[model samples]
Target: TQGPHPVWEHGLNGRGQVVHVGDTGLDYDHCFFRDDSQPVVFYPQKNEKHRKVLSYQEMVEDDGTRDHTDPYSAHGTHVAGSVAGNSIGGNGVYNGMALEAKIFFTDLADHSQSLYLPPDFDYYFRPALEMGAGVSSNSWGSNDVTTYYVDTDRETDVFSYFNQEMLIVVASGNSGRRMGILSPGSSKNALATGSSGNNMMTRNDLSSFSGYGPSWDGRIKPEIVAPGQGIVSAQSDGRVNSNNCGTTSKSGTSMAAPLVAGACALIRQYFMDGWYPTGVPTPSHGFKPSAALVKGMAIHSGHPMQGRLGNRGGMLKGELPEDAQGWGLMRVDHVLRFADSPFNLHVENNVTLKHRERWHKCFHVDSGTLKVTLNWVDAVAAFGVRRTVVNDLHLTVDSGSAQWRGNRHTNDFETNNIIETVQVEGASGTYRVEVYAKHVPVVFPAGQPLALVLTGKGLREAACPQTCGHCVHGQCVHGQCVCNAAYHHVDCSLCDDDKLCHGHGKCHDEHLYKCTCDPHFVMDDCSQCEAGWYGPNCDSDCKCGDGHCDTVTGIC
Candidate 1:
């Protein structure tokens, strides 16, 4: 289920999408890169002289010095293969999530250098955007020791906010139980990913080396986790003797990031391909989901794992711990299933919210839970600012009698998304969801863009009773009030008459009928115990300090 097989079976293979991978250069001649069935379009490198450039600045940077054919550095090739590699060369054993998706490579690491600085956001992100790439995969990050040297930038945030289309996926470094995440991965707009084990059923545990997180400002850093352990992918030149002819296995958050990036491609293609679930209504024109909506769907569909392993971090209060597993392990199947759920309603585009503005929706629910999530890529703050939430939106759910608020914790103030869940156990009523702008940034001229998803159980009609009498201490099952083992009556409203003693005991019958005997009485009917005995059926004598004693209390 973690791979692309399930998604491809639904006829979505990311056919028209382009994903950008930023790492060491790829081996262009690898058979996995060239498939007649679904050929991958490679981004023209600086060395390609005849390739057209978008601008003069891009043309000047095309110095042809970057060698994309380096076989020694197989990291970038492995990452790309895990993303969009085809089955033509690997005998269908090592196909990526998006087999038909195009690949765009950006050389961020040189094989000759041992230590290289992280690439600027403009170096790869801007290029991917210019080429109309909807998703970008980044498998590199700065080490924990170099945190002081890396400057947090607002470029990714600015691009995501203005563009509102492309998604950036970054690897949360393989630092294990470390407190903070890797550098560019900590960006507010990017989807920071941690590593899960390869086994999909047991993916709740994070990889031993996958980084843990709470960003510097205390927001959940790695928003999701994916399979990364011992992932088999294509190798450069087919000469590396690690595994089968042209494939090798690698483990790290680097391997996990591309899986998510490929998933993003499939999600983008699902909407772009005009594929809507059956019985669900669509507007006159096919709707396209925003990047924020996609991010929200991924995070909201995550399955929580923090409490299962007794690894509950102190900061975590609810079922999910933001610092440990973020939303939880990534489940693309759950995301797709949620999209097809009849009860769910997703916003197709971003909606602007002015100061003090509100949006509301009413839905009916019965005997289950109601969940609502509001997500947005907030405006980027200055590099060193402690607070990152630029536009604070509030989510509230009213069930007529009570109301629940998202972000209910008093101390948390930095996260950009809000999720609210209400329990409607055995209740039948209409619930109202309200989203309001609590704090809007003055810099946002038009207003903040937001995406909302409403999903959960729907209303269920009650089963009718046949006799039409009041049910007591029991519920109607198959048109009748089912009684407990100790009671026998039509509506389960009367005590068991057979268990009542002859003026010696009292019958109690709330949950079930039972008898409380008098001081000298014992037995099911309280008709066996005599003057000298007290126990049930007169099996034991009353023990007291004196010879003469009361039967039940054993008082002298």
Candidate 2:
């Protein structure tokens, strides 16, 4: 129900992965920081004078100086706990997604207050990449009211676009339902996460305070949603609970971002362990998934949440809305299942397309829907540039005689992801998916790296029955012929019972019925005789007995 705990039960606890949390700071000595067998390593801030020590607990208290015991420190600790907190007192209820993952912290807040600056992105993201962190959890953002447009630090965009190895998951900000997302999260390449409340049921509802978006450029923000409301995680020593346990309840997009980051860590471990889809090729040692692939899997496998909570206006008809709820709530189980499926294909690689070059994948549709998603991190542009997508790729699906294109708005340069879904609707046949580079910048000598994930029931390798052709207007379901409305015969070839060949023929092939003639009769309808015929219906013989006579001419 909640993230297939079987993932950990199967020994995929992010054994060798690292997750970086950029916030105030973390409580390194908390029980959550220590696994059952050993202690989790902590990577302290590099340049900060206060955090240069071996442990955050060693920081000296000064005139209102922020330490590991401050309220702001609890925020980072809670976020870190959500990413990789181990169970305390042998209880598994509070265990994090990647319990065994090592954590690195960067205090983005200034010494005096919790105010964050844009330069923090460079300070933290660069080092995390250098340390080989697979995932980075960022819970802080600019003010929602004060910042309106897609005003993110240019350096952040450059880091995210260049470092395809590590995924940067940021909070979508608690800016209510209408205010949109905040900076850093507003960066087109980052995986911005929104808040959702666990309902203890099959689905989680969107949190009302979670920000919604159609970014200033119209690209979808908050690419995925996760459980964030009233989440329990580790608390600083100064804010310990009455039971003396260092844990507290907090809610916001801040809590949601780390959950996704931890999930990424688990997925990274899955790849690092040499486990890939059935037909996929496992890379050599030191090969990890690209950030675009991680982000694509999380978004593509998500469940859509448009009409569930009566927030069904706008573009919420069946398909996923571009601006709101993104590709829906993140389902870790689905992502794992997709990765393990033998039939589906997940391609995570870089391909360069020289002018008009196209990549095509041909597959057969058995009897259901086909879904394909193409995502890539675009290059960073100058501040205030109207177009964000430097390289453009288009997705198109051709099934049988019909063709469908992905959702492309008028402003195509603004969006970086393309999803194309085709419902066979009973008509099953072969399909071809084409991904072509529509445009490429002159400066990019090597093509961009694109993450492609193709899934659905149609991808399963099942052959249709040979008799499927008889069903003219309908599809073949489970080796049976499901005929269209106009036809009613067994093989769906004859129009009606009245059209039968006077009980002389039987409908057996894709075409009309064939007649079983007697020894003397010939022709498809059995109305003509073999040799010499005369009288009514050619039943009477020609009187030239013992003499050979022509079938058509009675000359003897």
Candidate 3:
């Protein structure tokens, strides 16, 4: 939310987006919860602009006790504010990341602000899914189990795998230790977050309280970090014992989680508005980026940190996405790529892969940082399992004679994790980044849906014919040649049959890419006239009169 007013002015502050929250409970009556300055209204009324929470419900546990039995959280209110609360309550100062976005709230807490997933965790998910929320922000987790893929973790991953389009954001707990991220945060598909100081861009100022992790199963935890220390957000009137609208300054990984979720709201909107591929939302190239794609974009956009805090957090691994900082801190602009001139960004978003199938992008890079990120929503692993990754996809980048494998040295690609990232100082040559399915136990026939994001300074997806053969005037998208209007076929090697010589002449060969015009007209398309007039070019003046005419003889 840095310089948020300008972000709103640019129309990138999460307009036309909705993020759901599963927490203690949201203060629906808070002024910041309302859009603009209008009064708040309860559920079922459908307040389009005046209110921000599109749906709200309290969870009823399997034991027949409601979550409202516990004291309501001023903390949940603060977290929701950080996600989508308006700045009106803060007098325009304490704005959420996606200020214009709406939200759905599901109370999942019974005892306190800390989260507790019941036996029927699906109950908390129904309200948001029914309301069509694309993202869910979870600020609580079970820190008791360490970073294992426990039942909660499996359930979280299973729901996302089944839903496909929904992304759940979780917070790394406050405990500061290696491999100490909480459950659900340890969920394979969750966008787990760490805590960074507010003033910094990188994790150089990473908070000491922020949780650190490389999950028990070897997946990097807290995929990104954001401003979590001393963050200010809207406070609930009832929780603070005041009826007047107010704001509160809080800290923890909880605060950090919502900031990332808010950023995702903007990222989701960028896609829905069809502004991502080429930044043109006019006709709307919009598509819902699968959870894998959006998660890849956010994690890929993060920047690494450097300092004592960085050294301590990162432990000088000489590579990115280590335990403490993960991929670094969130950079919203990098995801949007507003003008398209700065970074050479390319994405194969939501493409399916089969067993032993290889998907690759061949490009050339001059001298810059090259990063390849792969994310997939893996199938659920059963409870009490030593391994959690269900469908393993291997990532390798071949640059010249050197090749870099993702999570190098982990070697357990099959059971490693669902995300694999390869980053290197790219040389000046053809670079091929390949994602090969290693052990796709499930998703047969249909293929496993996944996303790959690539970016660098001078990276160019230059070679098309190498991957897609004979693609004349065509660009490859999603493993297929997107031929221009003039070309067609599997490789886009064929030209238009009806448009050959404008139907005025015969075609010698489609691959020749030339239309042999009739005696009447001449041009590439046979659209123009030669020195002498032909049949149609006669214009009812020449003596051809729909009859054959030879220019050499001038006879019909």
CA-lDDT, candidates in order:
0.63, 0.63, 0.72
- Cα lDDT for residue 385, candidate 3: 66
Kindly give the stretch of ten consecutive residues in candidate 2 with the minimal lDDT sum: 49-58
For residue 250, give model 2's deviation from the true position in Å: 1.5
Report the C-alpha lDDT of model 1 over 1-556, residue by residue, as the tens digit: 2345656777777787778887766665566664333322334432223111111111112345534443554787788888888755454577778878777667665554232433455665777777767888988876653232135436666677777788888898888655468877877788888887787454766777777667765567688888888898877762322323377889999999998898888877766666544322233434567788778767766666642322333322335535657777776655554344545333435888875466665666643555566778777676555556577777665554455656444322223543322333344567656666756755677888887665555533223323324345567675445766544343454454344654356667543334676666766667766656654335347665447655555455
Candidate 1 matches the true fold with a TM-score of: 0.70
Q: Could you report the Cα RMSD, in angstroms, for every candidate shown?
A: 20.7, 22.0, 19.1
Query: In terms of lDDT, which candidate is strongest?
Result: 3
- Tens digit of per-residue lDDT, candidate 2, span 1-556: 1454756765678767778877766655566764334332334433222211122311223355544433534687788888988755433567677888777666655444364544445655776776668898889887744242344545666887777788889998887556788877877788889887765642356776778676766667778888888888877663423223367789999998998899989878776766665423354533578887777777766776654432333333335644657777887665564344423544545555643356765666555556666777777776556646567677655553455555533222223543332333453566656566655555777876677766655364344333333345566765344666544422343332223333223333444445655446666655556777743334457768888766555666
lDDT of 3: 0.72
* lDDT tens per residue, model 3, 1-556: 4553434555787888888987777766666775445544334344555558776666565588655322434678889989988854544578788888888777776554555566755666655676778889999888485545677787788788888888899998988764388888888889999887776453467787788777888777878888898888877655422334677789999999999999888888878887766755644578878888889889887877654353254443424667777888788776565554466777888788876566876887776678888889887776666778778788877654466777663323324767778777745667777777756654356779899888776667867334433344689675455767765433344454345555455454434457766555667677755644534433323367677656544467
Instruction: Return whichever of 1 and 2 wins on TM-score.
Output: 2
Clashing pairs for predicted structure model 3, backbone only: 522-528
Query: What is the C-alpha RMSD, rounded to one decimal, of candidate 2?
Result: 22.0
* Index of the highest-TM-score prediction: 3
TM-score of each: 0.70, 0.71, 0.76
